[model samples]
Target: MARYIDAEKLKCSIDSETDSIFDWDMTIEELYYNLCKLIDDEPTADVQPVKRGTWENTNTPNQLRCSNCEIIHFIAQYPHGEINYCPNCGARMDGVLSE
Candidate 1:
């Protein structure tokens, strides 16, 4: 599992620190750059495949939904460890479940 910190929360923490230590003098560009750096330095989670099975001949566990194309893919069509991109839309599979 991966841990994620909201960027707004991080900015608030930085703002509090800089205000107390430097009189709130940090530029917006500097803050933005620091936030980007922090995000880039954060560790990425290992890709874990969603659980899959068949129920009454239908795909179960519903695999991962594509965020870009709004498509639900069956896990049986894709080989394990080879589903980094969406076959329908060529989009990156962020592994985020659809609502």
Candidate 2:
């Protein structure tokens, strides 16, 4: 199973301990990855996990995407509300844009 770390939580953690010296140069994703390394935690997902088992099983839409990794997932493979994590890169599948 893929693991997802909340981006907001991670950002708060980083901001509380770090000075402004490195903040200007880093993107959220960069800060997330670096923080994960420092704390030995799972990397942050670009978006929140989709609520699994929430989508109807039949005719589920197949257009969800991972904004960070840019990977598309097959919607039918997951049970509705059961696909919180991305299979490709372990990113949260929530807020996946339709494309």
Candidate 3:
């Protein structure tokens, strides 16, 4: 997630810090930048685009095949809406998939 500075809270905090007896090792702006850098260093995961496919019914009543992988999957029911991904290839079917 991206971080943003809250101007009102920062102003209030700076006002209170002005009354503190602690000696300044760095300028207030420099200290603020350092604190923000620490928060911005948090890890974020990247989502990669994957091959998309829909399930196609097979000869077996409860089995469906993946359009992308052509691997058959067995489920409790046929034409089920709950099956969202191809287990073998991880092709997504829950959202709008590109060719």
1 or 3, greater by lDDT: 3
Q: 10-66 in candidate 3: lDDT tens per residue?
A: 555555655452347778777777556544543343445577888777777767788
lDDT by residue (tens digit), candidate 1, 1-99: 556566666666667555443435788777777667666654554455443321111245746566566566776787675677777767655453434
| Index of the highest-TM-score prediction | 3
> In candidate 2, what residue range of length 10 has the lowest lDDT sum?
51-60
What is candidate 3's TM-score against the reference? 0.42
Instruction: List candidate 2 segments past 4 Å from native.
Output: 1-61, 94-99
**In candidate 2, what are the lDDT values of residues 36-74, reduced to their tens digit?**
575555365666654332112223356555555656567
Report, for every candidate in turn, its global Cα lDDT versus the true structure. 0.57, 0.58, 0.65
Clashing pairs in model 1, backbone N/Cα/C closer than 3 A: none
lDDT at 1, model 2 = 64
Which scores better on lDDT, 2 or 3? 3
| Alpha-carbon lDDT of model 3 | 0.65
lDDT of 1: 0.57
